[model samples]
Target: NAVDLGAVLEQFSLVFCRLKFIFGPMALHALDLVDLRSVLHITSPCGRSTYQVTGSSGKTYTCYKSCHYCSCPAFIFSVLRKNDSMLCKHILAVYLSQAMGACQELSVSDQQMCDILLAKDG
Candidate 1:
């Protein structure tokens, strides 16, 4: 019996497209899951405002507070799905935003901010 090559090709294409939609972001998200220690709190204009939320397995995450702004691939996906989910970056942003009031001294250094966060964590 002769196989319908054209029909098989069309079905394959459909399957591939669907898979791309499902797997593309997941693959990227896996990449996004990095070590918390890797997320160095570089001094940013936002003011020493960054930290990593590491999972038990050491997968670090950063959440976006806004739709167009996210530190991680998962944030973008959550934003697209219209879910207000908390990620490591988002929590850090919140902590820093609040910290700004407490650490308003002009002389405060970046290290001080880290100290503040560590203190609060304890």
Candidate 2:
């Protein structure tokens, strides 16, 4: 038996909406603002599949593209633990950056990551 992919996607959308409600409006709003150019992607020397994303707030979070994993709380609690395939804002931002060819890629050893972290701490 063939399954209707559209229907499946629609169901997923409903679940996403419900999850968003449970999480609160902040997450949804963040997702909406993900298209901003301020999102930065830092590449790892190990490979290009993993990145560290610096959002418009200047806070950095790690994103593993291969596993759709992010270190952000939204991804941890709302997506990973819930087994939701829908990405959080940071992940979505990275995807948007890649799709728009706007991501600034820097080598892992460039100290950009340290700079971002220190800036966040201050």
Candidate with maximal lDDT: 2
Model 1 TM-score (2 dp): 0.25
User: Model 1, stretches more than 4 Å misplaced?
Assistant: 1-40, 44-50, 62-68, 83-122
Candidates in order have lDDT scores of 0.42, 0.62
For 7-119, candidate 1 gives per-residue lDDT tens digits of 88888688546634655533233223332223333244445554444433455443222323444455556654656543334343334334333212233466665554452
Looking at model 1, residue 18 earns an lDDT score of 66
Clashes of 2: 0
On a 0 to 100 scale, what is the lDDT of residue 96 in model 1?
Answer: 36
Residue-level lDDT tens digits of model 2 in 64-108: 656676677777687778965477777766665676587766666
